[model samples]
Structures are given as structure tokens and as C-alpha cells.
Target: MSETLTLPSHLRAVRAAIADALGIDETEAVPEATLLGDLGAESIDLLDILFRIERATQVKITVADMADLLQGGIPDEEFGDENEVVNDTGLTHLEKVLPQFDRSQLTEPLTADGVLGLFTVRNLTDLLTERAAAAGADAA
Candidate 1:
């Protein structure tokens, strides 16, 4: 089942994550704020934002996934090869699963269509929550 996100709470975190990535104040971050113009993010900065979002949300998104997000939300089937590994950096026991695509390009600015074209941020958050719950259930 899909989990719903508390938009207020999620937005706050998302904004914070982006701010942290840009090394700026959260007050400067806003939904309408352009990562490039407002946040002073360049292409590399954008990739950093994506990684920050993944770290904050725990959803493993690939560069291909980001490109798909640029187009619109990706379907589960097109979510890329489920068999792919997710780089788990700094893990103790579990092997780290690296992202499928190149990390360098993640920071490029996504146009309105690019950003909105991807799955809604809420959907990405829910996907992460669902995975965590599934992992917890398996542990139990």
C-alpha cells in the first residue's frame, strides 16, 4: 500500500535538505525558489540536492530515475531494473547499493516540467516510507 505524506512536514524537510545541500539558510528556500537563481545552485549543486533528498527520504533514485522524473513520475515497471544494487555507503553489515547512474550529473537544474515531470515529491517520499516499512516487516 502507498503511504501519504504530511505536506507541511515533508515540505519543511525537503526545503531543509535542499538548503543544507546548498549551504544556505532554509528561509531562503521555497517551493517556487529556483535552485539556480534563488539558491545559487549550479548543475553540480543540483546533483547534490538529489543526493541530499535521497539521504533525507531514503528513496534510492538513479540519474535515469531523475531523468524520468524530469519527464514525469516513473511507473513501477520503468523504475529501472529492480535487480540493480543501491549503494549503501557507511553501512555496517548490509552491503551498500550504489546508484545506477553517474552521480556527477545529478545537480543539473530541472525545468518546471523537469521537476514536476518527475514523480511528485510526495510520491517519492511515500516510496521511501513504504520501503522502510517493508524492511521493518521483514525484520519482524
Candidate 2:
């Protein structure tokens, strides 16, 4: 049996925006899932996605917002070596950014590369949702 996923309106809109930006079908952009690995999104696609999302949702998103969301404002001191390996303290901060996934499941010697892999469709949805809510509140 196939189970259909019912995403919130904001999530659906965000997914559609990402898909449109990537020139892919909406079904391929799974909700609440990673964008890069799961949806074949390259670094070049991220800016396009952000632009499309802003146009579709009327919510401005910045790279700093994404960075803060993914890294939880974690300082650089948490990284150990030249590879930017995440130490335990860094992992703790990363957990705040990626509450959807279990940190225990992360590969050993978690690096900056691994953290980049954690960016998901849900993250985009959450960002848009929060921005929309804040805008609404401000207008009220």
C-alpha cells in the first residue's frame, strides 16, 4: 500500500518552489526530506530555490538565515582541525539546527561536509513558515 504524505500548505508551497527552481517534478522533491542528496540539488540550485521561494511565498530569505538555522550560531572554536571536524560541542550546537534527525546516526568524525548534507526540504519549509508568521504578526 502506498501512503500519501500530506504536508502543510506552507510546506507544499515551499516544495513546489524548490521543484520549480530545480526544474523537476514536485513529487521528486519529497517533503520533510533532505534537498541535496534526496532531490539532487547542487550548490548552484540553492540560490535559485531561495529566489523562487521568496517570489512564491513573499517571504525574504537570506543566506545568513540558512546558516544560522543549520549551524545554530555555533562559533568556529568548536571545529577541531583543518578539515573542520565537528567536535562534541559543535555536534551539540548542530543538533539544535537539525532537530529532525538523530545526531547518533551521524557518521563518525562528522565534518562540515556532513553538516551541509543535513539541509532538508523541511528546513526550507520551516524558514518560510517562520518568516510568514513573523510578517503576519508585524502587520497585525
Candidate 3:
């Protein structure tokens, strides 16, 4: 089997953390799901989720960003409701913007150690955001 490096990049690691925390399958972990009410995730679980997401995507998602995402942030009218776009922060849907990802590559596991290695709960989002901005610049 191909290693994780060959798979398409995704937020799978992030979802996996949420799933693990909620004791559910990855499929049930949707973007719109509330971490507390829907996934039964406690505040600490949310921090873990952010950490995993950063590890999985190599993107830093800030506390403000987390708040926005958790709250169903303001959407950009350009992408329509089908795509979750953050208008306030100028963030577009990754899937919409970067369509080249191979879904298979998204299967890699985001282990606890790996997630922790990437970020701490408090800094995960902000670090992820900074990384993403830098990456977007390189891609452009």
C-alpha cells in the first residue's frame, strides 16, 4: 500500500480526531456538526480536534478561526451555500480551491502524538492559518 505521502491531502486527520472523541465513524463527522452538541465533544476534545486538523493539513487554524467555524461563520456569497466559505477572513473552501487532491491520500491516521507534535490546542488554529497563508502564496 502507498504511504500517506502519496494520498490527496484533506481534513481527514481533523475528522478522525472528532470521530475518535465522539466514538463515531468518520462519515458522521460533518463540517457543520457542532462539536459539543452533535459530536458530544467537550471543550478539551475541541482543542484536540484543532490540533489534529493542523497536523493533518499542515494548516494553522486560529482560535478566532475556530470560533468562526464552530459558529457557522459568515459565508462568501461567491461560493454559494453548498460550499462553506469564510468571507470575513477571505478563506475559501479548500476542496473548491484546490481540487487536485487525491481522495485516497486522505486516509492517513492522525495519531495523538503526531497532532501534539504539530500544535498545542491553544495555538493550533492560528498556526494553521499562518501556514495556510504561506502555502497559498507559494501556490499562487
Winner by TM-score between candidate 3 and candidate 2: 2
Candidate 2 segments whose C-alpha is farther than 4 A from its true place: 1-6, 79-82
For model 3, the stretches where C-alpha displacement exceeds 4 angstroms are 1-11, 68-134, 138-140
lDDT of 3 by residue, 31-124 (tens): 5454565567666776676676766776765555644432334343532233442232222332232233222454453222222222222233
What's the C-alpha lDDT at position 98 in model 2?
72
Scored by Cα lDDT, where does model 3 land?
0.48
Which candidate achieves the best TM-score against the true structure? 2
Per-residue alpha-carbon lDDT of model 2 for 1-140, expressed as tens digits?
A: 32226567787787788778888888777765687788888877888888888887889987678877767766766544567888877777777767776778865887776676688887888888999999999999
| Backbone clash count, each prediction separately | 12, 0, 11
TM-score of 2: 0.84
Q: Rate the local accuracy (lDDT) of all candidates.
A: 0.48, 0.77, 0.48
In model 2, the Cα lDDT at residue 41 comes to 85
Q: Rank the candidates by lDDT, best first.
A: 2, 1, 3
- For model 2, where is the 10-residue window of minimal lDDT? 1-10
Best by lDDT: 2
Error of 1 at 7 (Å): 6.4
- lDDT of candidate model 2 versus the reference: 0.77
